[model samples]
Target chain A: MKFTYQINGAEHTLTLEKHPEGYRAHLGTAIYDVKLLHAKDGQLHFQLDETRHTAHLAHETPAKRWLHNAGRTLVIEKAATHRRGADTAGGSGRLTAPMPGQVRAVLVAVGNEVTAGQPLLLMEAMKMEIRIAAPHAGCITALHATEGGSVNKDDLLIEVEEIPT
Target chain B: MPQFDRVLIANRGEIAVRLIRACRELGLSPVAVYSEPDADALHVRLADGAVCLGPAAARESYLDMNKVIDAARQTGAQAIHPGYGFLSENAEFARRIINAGLVFIGPPPEAIEAMGDKAAARTRMQSSGVPVVPGAQDLADDTKIQQAAATIGYPLLIKAAAGGGGKGMRIVHSAADLLEGAAAARREALHAFGDDRLILEKYLTDARHIEIQILADQHGQTLHLFERECSVQRRHQKVIEEAPSPLVDESLRAKMGAAAVAAAKTVGYTNAGTVEFIVDPVTRDFYFLEMNTRLQVEHPITEAISGLDLVHWQFRIAAGEALPFQQADLTPRGHAIECRLYAEDPANGFLPATGTLLKFSTPPGPGIRVDSGVESGSVISPHYDPLLAKIIVHAADRTAALQRMQTTLQDTLALGLTTNLDFLQAILAHPVFVAGEATTHFIDQHLPNWQPAPDIPAAAIIAAALAELHSPSATTHTTASPSQDPHSPWLRLTGFRMGGGE
Candidate 1:
């Protein structure tokens, strides 16, 4: 079987085939004798060549998986054959929450003009207050965050449209 | 006075758990109080009885003194222990507990009030012959504050009089920024501590934060538990702590300890408290910072070295017990270090991350201790502190202790949500930290642009790929008998499993 996997935004082609001794697997340019002992609950215990290893994986979404191994976490995704263009182009004008938190204060209104580094809102998380600043000088076209509202990571907070000089 | 069988812990998190353990060892039943969000907290689970205070907001729960006292009454607890944060230093709370005929496992309300005000504490320290940093006190307006700032020279700090945890602190480098800085500081102080009073102090650019732990009894006995160096801070909040301070010597420690004892005596402080100081590295001069009239978050390091349980002593002292040992009999054993594990992403501006902890495995071994309030499946909410745990280690010497701490941190496994674990490891391995030269500005100066490891290792990539391939979904696509095939080469290999064999 062959598949394309995206690890940390980089894509790699991997192939696996049965061998007399375990299985022969080709990942990118390297090939190894992959002996699968067991796989369940997002944990894979296997032997690569002579070395033993365990990897934990969590299904994040249809296209994304969180892989934890070697004291580090890497987000891996099954590469999609088709690309969506609207999502990529629409991100520039939107402000998203950097982390999960509560919006303590919203300093900008829908029609407010803001500078690139002007303070836009205050977020409170982990008992610490953080000031979210505007990314660029623009007119606030939309405000999605309300005072004392909870926000998750990547939640759209506001939308700004650039003001033509 | 009544003999209390049950102690009420009017707090949440690790300190509450710590108090519960102490109470159990002391033959006292512990009753826990929790907010709605913390109904299933570890502390609550460990206690003999638990009561829900209110909602998730601290104001409605932890900081609500009446609610806490009422919970204690409802639980039939004769004594109340307010762990470090929340109402620990609230004088009114202490008074209420005492008025409710319950022993407050801490100093008297007067002592907390004296040390609670930074300006008042400085005045008391100076009068008691302790060295205090030169600055303005009790300035009524910004004009006077600016004048005082000018007299104190540039680079002075404006600190909240009623602040702890660096909530409202600002540094002014010149006259141009003094007024605005004071205004910002006042605004934050009012918001965080409910007190807008500000005090100015001479900013020591290269000073080290050293604090002496003082334990006193109602019998008028007082002793110092030496000092802990808390210089490694970010935004004036301590992240790492150890005892004794690398900057202090025999004579310096004695001097600082004496001053701390004097400060405690002047305030008639009872129970456990800490007198903080700012030490000039070059001249070895120390100035009084403020006295914390409650058990500190980093008290474990002191326990590791002294072999004494501070919380247990707090209970005993509250019960009118005398000091067990004299100043000469107590000797610190060895070096100990503590690192605060926070739910934060150091790579992304150290912002706090909130999510359910998917995996939480603590490092266990000799000379290692973990005081944690969280575990796997625990949700880190935004309404409370992000301190997940404290990883502490002790060894025969500083070098050995550092090594042990490094190994323990590396072995620690906490997945899901971002954390400062990797960032902490980087600090521990830094050359300056190894040399014991990390001052308060070490993190800001050395790692101003520090980033987490950008890429995964080759082995990890391969393992991840293989794990994905052998996932249940992928296996379902293959022949079912392949997994059980006696002739299958995979059967020849040793037992291997993925996804924890679920």
Candidate 2:
């Protein structure tokens, strides 16, 4: 079986084949003889070559997994075989909630022209206030966040159309 | 016997757990109160009794003084311990608890009120012969604010009069930004603390935040527990704390400790309290910042060095005990460092993260203490503070303590959500931090753009791949057994079987 995983925007492919003694894993040009020592409840104890490592893997979604080992955690996602093109409608002008929080105020209205880095909204999360700003000089085309409304991570807060230089 | 046999802990999170343990050690029945979402919180499970306050919104539940008092009454609790935050520092809440014939395991209402307001505290400290930062307060209008700003000069701070934890603070570099900065600070202050009053202070560049812990009994004896250095801060929120500040010598320690005791005495404070100060690292001169009438979040480091359980003392003092020792008898033996473990993304503006803590583990060994409120399978809700735990380490010296803390952080693990663990390690490894020369601007000046190392280890990738292959969902494409096969080297992992495993 061939598996492709993405970490920090980079993709790596791993191929695994059944072996009589254990399993053979091919990661790039390096081949690894892997032996599973113990596996239970998201905790995996395995040996790759001469090193023994313990890692915990938890699945957040079908394609996303959190892998932790030796005090480090990495967000690993199964890379989609079919890649999508860039979002042309909003591009860099789309503003989203950085984290789950409540919109404290909306500083800009639809159709308002904003300079780069202009404050557009205020959000409250974990008892701290954060200011959301415009990414570039643009005109607000849509406003999705309302005052005192709750928003999830990556939820669209605003959309802006870029102003030509 | 103590004055109260049953005590209600009127808070949640790690502090509540810490108080519960202390109550048990003192042979008192600890009762816990929780909001709707915190029904299964670790504190509730560990307490002898628990009551549901209300919904998840803090205002409706934890912060609702009426609900908390009523819960204590119904639970048959004779005393209430507001373990920091929530209603811990609220003077009205303390008075209400007393009026209800329950012992409030903190200072008197008069003390809380006097020191709760930062501006008022500054005035009182100045009158008590304590050095105060040059600033002005109670500026009701733009004209008064402008006058104060002119006197304080450029690079001043606009802070909320009723603020802590840096919620309503703004720094203005020059005259041009004064009015705008004050307006923004006022709005934030009103929203966060329900008070729009602002105070102006001259910004102290590269100053260290040192605080003295003072304990007082109802019998009028007050003694200081020395000092804790909390210089590693981000936006005024402390990220790391240590005891016996590297900068303070015996003479400075005695001076700051005496000033802290005098500050508490001026307020007639009782139980455990901390007096914060802003100290110039070069001259060793310190100015009174504010007095926390309740226990502080970083009290564990002080406890580590002083060999005193502050919570135990709070209970004893509330029970009408007298001081058993003199100030000279209490001495710090070693160095202790504490790092706050928060469920926030350090690489992403330190924004809080919420999810189920699928895997939670702590380092276990001598001189290592982990005060936490969550366990595996616990949910990190968005309705409360994001502090998950506090990891503290103690050793014979500062260098040994720092090294132990570094290893302890490396040994601890939390998965299934973003955390500041790696960022904490980075801070521990920084040259300035290791040298113990960090000030309040440590995070900003040293690691303003810190990001976790981009490279992922190959072993992690291989483990994830193996786990994926062993998952029950992958059984469709391969003939791997769903159960652990004795003859096979690969053990089939169970739990969280995706896609309706057969």
Candidate 3:
């Protein structure tokens, strides 16, 4: 089916395909290996695996595109896609690293106003200094890291409440 | 030689797996050693047999000399090959292995001890007319030290007697910073190498870190396997090493090779080892940096260029074999580059980070060889080097190899932990690195600070966005919307899914 679409502020026609497994989408001339997990109201969450990583793409029906590849072909319908259980995530404690690095300077003052991308702390992982930007605009209700700290994969940095801006 | 049929590797991670490959190719029975953390490591599965070495702490396992020797003895092994770092260069350990009547598979104890002492090696090289660096006499008083530095030149280096890595090294431009720099060097030296004694030398900026690999036998025949450029470093530790350096031409290669041979012969060097040199780019002149009497991390580039296996050569030479490939017959054919894929965040100051491999996948194509120590499910704990793999690319020229590396880096992906992926991408993208204008200060001179590219690749954004939601252990986001849209949310959600509030 052809649908009038606007992504990244560009108007285009997208071809949506229904397959034996999931929906195949060809949007903006690029093939999207898109997988839908849970669709509630106007929100549709999907996963995208291009080459190496399988990305869970949160695709809102009335979506916003941050970028559009110039002179690039999109074949979302032709891209290989798969569906994984949305409930597959069976655990808790969702603290993610602000960025990849060794925790050098974690300025977690317990509770603080951490706007989305707020500079929560600093880390030196690959001989470079990078400020740990807050994942979302939130009130940091809990601080997980300390100054002069060492954190491993998925180790907590800080806990923030996702209060609407 | 005390002989055994099988040898158990007393380490986990990459070097252990590398050793297992060497052992299997050499027709020796291989045994895997694991910590509680590495029972699922790639090395354990690859080995013919596996034994739990001990807990995850290296000091209790890999660095535990007694435990290592005991594992070797218990597994009925003839020798222990300390593959570089963790106890590979330790002289005391080598001596103990010798006293235990087990082959060390490296240079003699005397060579390790001699090179271990930077003072003695400098003295020996100087005596042998190896064109030693001009430095102060050992440990002069404050005034005498100033006088010595003044005599040497305005910009002189106060290098630690036990220095190998960039630690314990101080560059004094004038007499003003002499005392403080000296004290700092001494403290770092004492901490790193147990020896606070330092010698002075001229500090040459814009130098290339090139080194020649030498294989000397007990029969007095020593040959060079060409050189590798390793100037790309962070915190004095070499992060990337490449062979047939883009800087050195044929004539320069010969001169550097000869000097390396001379340095090795001066100390009666043998086995698979590297003689490091700090080479001036403009003058094409070089100086002896130090000797690493063990396998280098980037030996694959050497192996690719020379078409000779240094590790196999090591075993053969240790097993009373002569240098199989003559120096005259060996010549580098192509330009090769190796980027060490460390488990650190380059956005940060390259501090080491540890994590379990969630989704480890490499770029698949030609002209690329990945020397990986861990796999998709391996755990990279804080107990060892954060280097997960060495992504090596070979091509007809340096440009092709570099392009291949950039493509490979873009294509590769790892979930669950952060890495220096973007940092490496930035370095390779630099005009200087592309122009083959690499130096010891390449990182400093070019990228003193990290900046996020305004235009990140479409693939990366998509991957990051997709990763935010799809990654195995990620929290399910209700919507990928403007309010909670863009890929960074998936990144943010990675935290929320785990319920990591406290």
**Distance (Å) between predicted and true CA of B481, model 1?**
31
Candidate 2 chain A weakest lDDT stretch, 10 residues:
A81-90
Give the candidate order by descending DockQ. Answer: 2, 1, 3
Span of ten consecutive residues with least summed lDDT in model 3 chain B: B474-483
Window of ten residues with lowest summed lDDT in model 2 chain B: B474-483
Error of 3 at B269 (Å): 1.1
TM-score of A-chain in each prediction? 0.46, 0.49, 0.38
Q: DockQ for all models, in order?
A: 0.07, 0.13, 0.05
> Which of the two candidates, 1 or 3, achieves a greater TM-score against the reference?
1
* Candidate 3 CAPRI level: incorrect
Candidate 2, what DockQ?
0.13
Error of 1 at B153 (Å): 1.3
Residue B476, candidate 1: alpha-carbon lDDT: 14
| TM-scores for all predictions | 0.80, 0.81, 0.72
For all candidates in order, the CA lDDT equals 0.81, 0.85, 0.68
| Chain A TM-score, prediction 2 | 0.49
Which docking class does model 2 fall in?
incorrect
Off by over 4 Å in 1: A1-17, A23-28, A36-45, A54-67, A77-165, B187-196, B472-502
